[model samples]
Each structure stands twice: as C-alpha cells, then as structure tokens.
Target chain A: MTTEFATRHLRRIRLVLWGVVTAVLLATGGALMMRSYLLPPTSEGISVEVATIGETDIRSEFTLMDHTGRAVTEADFTGRWQLVFFGFTHCPDICPTTLAYMASVLDLLGPDAERVVPLFITVDPARDTVPVMAEYVAAFHPRLVGLTGTEAQVAEAARNFRIWYERMDDENAPDGHMMAHAGHMYLMRPDGRFDDVFQEQDQSPQKMAGQVLARIQESQDVK
Target chain B: MRVLIVAALAVMLPLAAHAEVVVTDPWARASILASRPGAAYVTAESDEDDRLIGASTPIADRVMIHAIETDANGIGRMVHRKTLDLPAGEAVDFAPGGMHLMLMGLSEKLVEGTTFPLTLHFEAAGEVTVNVPVLGVAASRLDEGSK
Candidate 1:
C-alpha cells in the first residue's frame, strides 16, 4: 500500500514540474513575438552621435557614371545604405587594399549587411572605363559597384565629394599613364545625406564598421 | 614551384655573397597595418655596400618590397621594386606607406586573432624567420595621424 502511494506522488510531482516549464516557455515566446511586432528590427537598442558635415549653407549634387557608364544621380542611392569610396582602377595599391578592407568589414557585419551598399566612385574617370571598373571591382566582391564618368561629370562629382585626383605621366610607364587619387570612404544614410566620412589615412574598415555596428546594438548583442 | 625556387634563391643569394644579413624585427613586431604579411625591418650590412639584391618569403607565395607613390593630386599609387640596396650596416625599413613587403597569394587567410609564420631573405640576412601577428584592417600612412 505504501509503495503504490509513493509511486502516485512521484507522478504528480513530475506533472507539476512539466507544467511550470511549459508556462515559462509560453510566456517567453509570447514576449518575443510581441516585441517583434512592436518594433522595427533596427529601431531599438542602438544609439549614434552623428558627425555633422560642416557645409551648413550648401547642398551638393553629383552625376557619375556607374559600371554601365549610365549617368547616376544622387537619387540612385535612395532607400539603401551607401558605403562609398573615391578611387581609381589603376590605383594598384591603396585603393584596392582599402576597398578590400571595407569588403571584409561588410562581411563581418553579417545579417544587416544587406542594408549597406559598397560603392567605388573613381576619381580617374578618363582612364577608368566602365569595363575597367567592372573587372577591377569583380576581384573585391559581387556587390562592390564601381562608378566612373566623362571628365566633366567626374570633376563635378569629385568637387561635390571633395575628392582630389590627377594623372601622372610616367615616362618609363608600366602602362604609360596612371592616375593617383585620394583614399576616402563615405557612409551615406538611406536618405543620401553624408552620414560619415572615413579617410583612408584615418580609419580602417574594422573601425568604420565598428561605427556601423554600433548603430545596431541589440542585433550585435545577440551574438 | 616557382615561389619555392625564388624563396630558396632569396635565401641562398645572401649566403653566396658571404655576408651576414640580419633581420632585426624577426616577428615584425612593429607592423604597420599594425600587423600582417609580418612587417619586418631588415638591416643588411655588406662587405661591398651592395643593393637590396632581392627578397623572398616562404610563408608567402610572392613577396615583393613595395612603396606607395602619391602624386600632386594627392592620390596614392603602388610601385614594385626589383631590389633594395644596403650599404654596409645601413638598415632598410619595410614599413607601411613607405617600403613594405607585399605578401601575395597567401595559402590561407590567416586566423584573425593569430599571427602566422614568415621568412624574409635579404642580400646579407640569408634567411630570417618570423611570425607576424594578424591585425585589424590596415589604415594608411595618411591615416597614421588618426590612429
């Protein structure tokens, strides 16, 4: 009689323990579902201090040639994150090296990376044809977009971004003529405002990406 | 095959010259990019004050000493050199934004937090072994101020 009673008591305890576990799990799942429905994925737990661009009195416009050499305006960047760099195809060293770093940073950014677009706007539009850009950017990543333009359009774009570029004549040239240009990567907001500028000499992709990652604290914390 | 042959040549050339080539920063501790390709500062004191005859790295498929060239427009470019010369104990700095070794066709992307092996050959230092700590992304000389 005692053994039978003891077995019945153990069954009751097990049933109560399972009920508590189920209740806890259900509450947690409901809370998560409610949170997801209430907030945008990127709208919570992230804070950033914007570094204001100094040109308070002026708004700038640019027209550059995309990889297709089709004219692209500032509006082309709408509704997406633009991580733009000013460089040339012939830059053989700094330009590619820096862009490759940016690519690595993007890779590290993981899921939300889809929101950022890596754009390479060349200062040497005269020499960097669309085909040249296509070939060059292919080495970096599938998403890297290269931009060039006619000399006039290229100059206008450079002025807007304050990019400095010039062609140097090498007498015993590797390819006869080459362009040397500054290395600066800019981060454009979804609305195309100049959100941040990363100077080649100032920041690495990791540091810049860190800034980007900081904008998504909760997502980052999940890791 | 060619990379090994060149690396071996880079090692043998210095010994053949009958001069001791010492690479001071074997670990390339003072790396610009802060780390990677193992930044090494090598000094080749020579009997005849010879040029930096050649260079090689066993860990790297193609290692070339490189320098950045910035033009008036302030855009940067890269130029590869065949050799750098050392005149009797003078040191050559293979640093970033200046003269650096370009490690091409790496067998693998080095582990992020770990540094791997590299060997630098000089006209005098026949073979100097080193392990370069992989570092965060590289920022250029111009960026040195920011760093």
Candidate 2:
C-alpha cells in the first residue's frame, strides 16, 4: 500500500514538471513572434544599417573642372549634399548602368533631390575631356555634373576619396585601353563631410532614396 | 539498304539539333558617345548542348564576349571569355553587369528605336543572325519604360 502511494505521487510530480517545460517553451515562442512583428521592415535582402564616417578615413576634398569647363572645388558644394561616383565614359556596362541608377534615385527623391548634387568624376582623365563629359552627363540627367581634371588633380581627388583605379591594356578596345575602378558611390553631408558609402550591390532606387532621405531628415532634426 | 538509311539518319539528326538553338530578345544599349564601345545582351536557348564560340556585326570592328567580375573589395573588372557553354534545355542570358557582347570600334552611335543585325556563331549551330534593337542609354531591359 505504501509503494502504490509513492508511485502515484511520483506520477503527479512528473506531470507538473512537463507542464512547466511546455509553459516555458510557449512563452519563448510567443516572444520571438512578437519581436519579429515589431521590427521594422527591410528592403528585399538589403540591410538598412548605415555606415557612418567614423568607421572609415573618407574625406571630401577635390579640385576638378566641371563639365561646363568651370573650375570648382569642394567648397562650392559645401551647402548641398553630394553624391559622388567615379567612372570613365569608355566603360560600356557598369558606368552607364550606375549613372542610370543615379538618375532614378534623383527622380525618386523629387523636390528633395534639389538639395543633392550628383557628381560623376572620371578616373580616366586622359580620354574624358570637358566636351566628352558634357555630352555624356547630359544624356543621363541635366543636373548630373561630370568632373575631369589634370592627371595629378584627378589622382589627388581619387586619393582623398580612397578610390582605386588602374588602366588595363586591351588591344581590341576602342582606345586600346580600359579602366577598372571601385564601383562604390559616396554620400556626403551638406557640411562637406563623408556620411555614407553605397556598394554596387545596393543599387535599388527606392532603397537608395529612402536612405538619403533619412539622412536629410536626421540633419534637419539636429538643427 | 539498311546501312544507307542509317547514314542518312545520322546526318539528319545533327541538322535537327542545330535547328533547335534559338536566340531571342537581342538588344544593345545605345552608346552615349560614339567613340566609346557599346554593349549588347541576348538570350540563347538550345535543345542540344552547344557552345557560343564567337559573334560579329558589321557596325563594330570587333565583337568580343566579356564578363564583369567583382572582387572582394567591390572593384569591377572585365574579363574576356573565349567561349560560353549552352547546356541542353537551358536558357543563357547575357545582360548588363554580367556577360555581354562588347562592340569595339562602333561605326556609328547606336540610336534609340533603331535596330541592327548581330550574328552569333555557335559550335554546333553554325551562324545565326538576329536584329537587335537599340534601347536608351541607361536601358536595362527592352520592356522597361522610359525613365
């Protein structure tokens, strides 16, 4: 009789233990679902994490001539946000594709785009002259500015921006040469400070515009 | 009689296989500058395994198949490919920022709304020419609306 009583007591204890374990699991699962539901939506597969200037040694300083044959420096664009891209007109694929993407980004920004200046700086200054830059930039967007300077000037600008470019010889190319350059775009603040960098993979127009708009809003908030 | 019939079937089979390869949606990005090279993309499908050996066009001095490869640091470099395999029953796409036909020494600017002829040479299919439409300077696809 005593053994029967002990077995019955043991079964009751085991049932209570299982009940506690199931309650814990259910609570954890509910919390996870709530966390996912509360999180902000992300763009497709892109991460919305903003990379600030503190992480990199990027600076905004350049002395180059605009497509209109006017000499300008970073100081001229101190009051406006800058979107910079480095490429050559001889580039058949990536350059044109990227320029088009920039144009779309500007369009998506609408009136807010007025506060942004998109600059296309040529890494191959030897072939990309003022006239070439003018016609090329005009084809994409009227507001888009093409910058080219002397070899040393362009090199200095590239160095300040931490851009790496090299001329590769191709016997079959149009000019018997081609240029390979870093395909990243830079976003700078109105105060002429580096703000963020967008890699080639993050070329979505909506996502890019949203990121830029967020920065613009954040700057205003600080003011 | 049986041997003669078998030889005739052998010759007809290769010809039928060659006829199965089809190229569609051939288009080229309009050259922003006439002095710069142009890029063209197309979709090729084959019923039998074949190889894209070469391509040619009267508008360009040299036509080369090129691919853009990005390094770990996101630097893009163009690599020339001698040949590309087209496996049976699969479609191969040559598009922007990917495999493309580099049209070197363009005779004239590729104007929008215009079409040019591009001849593709295959290892088994011989030569096939398709009229390629010229899209906008920044056009990614033929159906993409004006931006």
Candidate 3:
C-alpha cells in the first residue's frame, strides 16, 4: 500500500513537471513571436534592404519656356511632382533612352502619373527651339513637356539645377559639334525640392516608378 | 548519321569562320527632324582581332564614330574617333554616354518602330550590314520589346 501511494505521488510530480515545461516553452515561443511581429525593427543588428540616395536642396527659381512657348517656372510645376531630365533633341542615345524609361515608368504609374510632370529640359538651347522641343517631346509620352530658353535663360536654369553642359567643336565630328550634358534624371518633389537622382545603371521603369510612388507616400505621411 | 553530321559541321564552320566579327542589336534614336544628327549603337563581337574602321548608313549623308566622355569638371564632351579597337573574343558594346555612330545630315526623320539599314566596316570582317531599328528618343538600352 505504501509503495502504491509513493508511485502515485511520483506520477503526479512528473505530470506537474511536464506541465511546467510545456508552459515555459509556450511562453518563450509567444515572446519570440511577439518580438518579431509587435516590436519596431532595430537598426544596429539589421542590414538595410533598400538604399536610397541622400536628398539635396535644389534651387526652386528659374523661368524657362515650355514646348508650347509658354513661360514656366517652379510655380508651373508646383502641386505636382516633376521628373526632370536634361538633354537635347540631338542627343541620339542617352536622352531618348532615359525618356523612354521615364515614359514606361509613368505608364506603370497609371492614374498616379496624373499627379506627376515629366520635364525634358534641353541643355542645348541654341538648337532646341520651341518648335523643335515640341516636336521632340511629342515622340515620347504625351505628358512629357520639353523646356528650352535663350542661352542665358538656359544657363541660368542649368545653374539653378546644378547641371552642366558644353559645346563640342570637334572638326572631325559628323555633326560639326555636339552638346554634352549631365545624364542624371532628377526626381523633384511637389514642392520643387530635389528628392533623388537616378543614375544610368540603376535606372529602370519599374524601379523608378516604385521609388516615386514611395516618395509621394512618404511626403503624405509627413503631412 | 555520323557522316551527315560531319558534313553539316564542315559547311557551318567555314561560314562561321568567314564571318568572324558579328554585329548585333543595331539601333538608333529617332530624329525629331530630318537633316539633324542622330546616334546609333551596336554590339560588335569578334572571333578574331578586328577594328571598327567606320560605319555607313544611307539614311544619313555621312556617318562617323564618336565617343562621349565626361571631363574632370564633370561636363560631358564628344570626342571624334576614326576607328575603335575590337580585340578577339571581346564584345564591344556601343552604348549611350559612350562610343556611338553619329549619323549626320539625316535624309529623313527616323520614326520610332521603323527599321533602317546600317553597314559597319571592320578591318577583318570587311562590311557587315544590319537593320537599325529606331527607338524612342530617350531610350537608353534596347529592351526585348524594342528588339
């Protein structure tokens, strides 16, 4: 009888131990899941997935003529985000390629593209006249606006954007000479602030469209 | 079956050996207006050492090889080149913001989606004609859809 009673006591203890072990395991698992799902991400031990370009300040002042011969400034682009690229119509490679990429990006954005302006500002203002700008932009997206101005106006606009351009007077050049300009595509916020710059290799329609949409959402969140 | 296979291989080998330098993905940006200069790009690879001496296209009055470079001050500039070196087993990609063919005095405006003929002259390959497809003005690389 005493042995039987001792055996029953041992079994009870074993059951309690198992119950405690199970409870502890469940608590630990719950804590880990909570830490993963509920807690904010810690920066020190984590690798950032997407790296973005640092934002910079851009000059918001300048008056230039749009493709339609209309005078335009930052005010003209206000209330809508602007995707600006600096190139001329004569630019056979970089300009057209970048514009096409931007066109695809805008197309992907669909209805969201209505809130954005794609601007093609000619660094070769001497040759990119109003009519030329109009015709050139027409070949790309319908929403693309080609901007040009007099030499001084173009210089001022380029200076404001911190972009560079120069005339090449090579005698052996088939075009007699050509204009060489910076090939960066700038994403300007609705407030005309410099948001990001898209380099050649990192540029894709889908990637840029996502970045633009994210930036817009970020700005809205800030407000 | 062995003899048939060997005969086919022999016939193919001679044709491939004669055409050492191959030009592919030839394309040009559409010109907004006729008589304006345009640029063309191509991927040229060689099984033997060769040099891209020049290029010709009837679409334009004259074609010249050019290289666009960035100066120390960060300003971009175009340099005229008479020839471009193409080493054996190496692929030379003529891309934007780099080496390209300048098509000057365009006889007609190159419209997007249209294809034109361009002839590339190589020191070893002699002359290789390619169909240069016209793409959008701001297109950088030839995507599958564009090709």
Candidate 4:
C-alpha cells in the first residue's frame, strides 16, 4: 500500500513539474513575440525585409514644372523607371549627399540607366525656382531632372507620395528659413506603381544598382 | 638663469595648452553652388574636458556649428549649436550626418581638389587652425590616399 502511495505521489510531482516548464516556455515565447511587434524598425533590420514593400499607400501622381520650365505630370514619365527624390536645393548636407548617391547608382547602372529617370522634386518651391533647380541638378548628374511647381502643386505631389516637409524660420539661414523633409528615395516601376523605397541609411550605390537591375530584369521576364 | 626660466615657462604654458587638444581629418564637401551653405567635418580629441566655442574660415562669412537630428521616421532636421562639449579622453567626430560646421555665406563655391584653412576655437586649447581638404560633394569620409 505504501509503495503504491509513494508511486502516486511521484507521478503527481512529475506532472506538476512538466506543467510549470511548459508554462514558462510559453510565457517566454509570448514575451519575445510581443517585443518584436512593439519595437520600432531599425535601419538594418527593416531594409532587408522586402515583404514590407507596398505596405504603405505611396503613389507617383504629380503635376509640376521640369527644370527646363516644361509642364509635366506622372504620365510624362511613363514607360520608364523613375527614381524620385524630394528635397530642396538650399539643403546643404542630406539633399546633396542623397543626390550624389543617386548619381553614383545611375553610373553603376551604365547603359541600363537609360531606362531610369531620376527626378528631384523640390519641397521649397518658394526658393527653389526652375533656374535654381536647373543649376542644382546640373552639379550632380547630367541626366538628373529637377522639378519645381507652385506651392499647391508641390503640396499635392508631396501628399500623394506621403512626404512630410516643414519650413522653420531661422535668422541665420541664407533665406531666413530652413526646410525639414523626408529623405527616402522612391523607386517607381515603369507602370507608375511603387516598386521600392530606399531609406537614407542605405548608402550603398553598388547594392542599389544591383537591386534596380534585378527588378528591371524581373519585370522584363514577366513581360 | 631666473630670466631664462621665466621665458621658458611663458612659451611652454601656451604649448602645453595647445598640446592638450589634437584635431585631425579636417575636410569639407565641395559646395555645388555659391548660394548654398557648405559643410565641414573634423575629429577632435582632448586630454582635458573642453568646449568648442567657435569656428571660422575665410572662405565663409560665418561658420556655425550644426547637428543633424533624425526623427523616428528618419526625417533629418538641422539644428544650430552654439558650442560642442568634448569630454576628456573622448574623440568627438564631426561627420557627414551628425555634427558639422555649417559654412554660411561662402565667398565662392568650394571647388573639389582644393584646400582651405579652418580655425577652431576651444575654451582650453585656444585657437587651432587646420588645413581642410575639399572632397567631392558626396564624399562621406576622407579617401584612402588623401589626408
């Protein structure tokens, strides 16, 4: 009788231990999943996830004046891949750096670059006139096209692309004001659909060119 | 002998203060246009805690210390800083995306492959002048061959 009682006690303890262990494991796994979901996307972690593409409703519809003072729209850039960047020429550091990167990416694309149209849309339309943009884009790549428009047109374009920009007055600034704007580069498909968005931290020209070429090839294969 | 010792102390005092801080890798991005501001970067190391009070260059009318702060969405805003603190035994880097010297009202466009003198003023180190090399507009760091 005592032997049977001890065996039953041992079995009860073993069952309780197993339940505790399983509960601990489940809690730990749940905590890890929650942490990942709550954490903000880091530069290194988020750029690799191609699945996140198109999750945001980004469009390429805009009516603006080209650097040559020609009126144009999204339809004007149809049948060609567009790399769109929104910035002001007055910006000294980030805008120029990103434009230089875009120029390098184009150089890396070489002949295939002809299929791509790199657009620089100004956020500060008040200061970035057609001639200013013409001179600014000329300093970067020969093929780079600069675009500027009226405040309402620029605002509509920025809203379509989900770009945020604000002008802050500064006494020391050249124009007595400075603009803060998003720095992401948008790669639009030939069909005017958003293909990918390059973050400011992605400064690799070679990698960008490779990705662009791969996408182009993929689209061609589909056709 | 006493007169010689006094003269030696006077010369050595300034030298000692200057030797406490070392500035290197001074460089600036070539300005794409004369109407726009230019940016310059340098690495500074100090033996004792010091503050970078001001900076100046003959090429620009004003040299303002600025820092680029990025929000969670990766939007960058340029903030003007009156001074920068350099802690003891720590190297403060003024790089492309972080802290930089904003050269405002430039006399002329900063052409590539050129050099200019940048004078930095420190609370303890006094005024130190570094010959800054102008790199390409998109250059993030000094090239391997160029100093």
CAPRI verdict on model 3?
acceptable
Instruction: Please report the interface RMSD of model 4 to 1 decimal.
Output: 6.1
TM-score of 1: 0.50
How does model 1 score on DockQ? 0.07
What DockQ does each listed candidate score? 0.07, 0.26, 0.25, 0.24
| Residue A165, candidate 4: C-alpha displacement in angstroms | 0.4
Tens digit of per-residue lDDT, candidate 1, span B7-64 = 9999987566676655554323222221123333333345546565455555556665
What C-alpha lDDT, on a 0 to 100 scale, does residue A128 get in candidate 4?
82
lDDT of 2: 0.80
lDDT of 1 by residue, A1-223 (tens): 9999999999999999999999999999998865544322322111111112243322235777778667788787677777877765434345655776777778878887888888887665655779878776776777888888876887777666655444433322222223333355677666666666665446666777788767545334755
RMSD of each: 23.5, 15.9, 20.2, 13.2
TM-score-based ranking = 2, 4, 3, 1
TM-score for all models, in order of appearance: 0.50, 0.78, 0.73, 0.76
Best by TM-score: 2
Q: After aligning candidate 1 to the native by TM-score, how far in Å is the CA of A61 from where it should be?
A: 3.4
Q: Model 1 lDDT vs. the true structure?
A: 0.57
lDDT of each: 0.57, 0.80, 0.75, 0.79
The residue-level lDDT of candidate 1 at A53 comes to 29
Our model 1 lands, by Cα RMSD against the true structure, at 23.5
Higher-ranked by lDDT: 2 or 4: 2
Better of 3 and 4 by TM-score: 4
Give the alpha carbon lDDT tens digit for every residue of A55-100 in model 3.
Answer: 4556545789999999998898899988888877666656666777
Per-residue CA lDDT of model 4 for B1-147, tens digit only, reads: 999999999989876676467999998889877777888989999998899999999988898887765558544556677789999989999876567788877898998899999999998888889999899876866762164
The better-scoring model by DockQ among 2 and 3 is 2
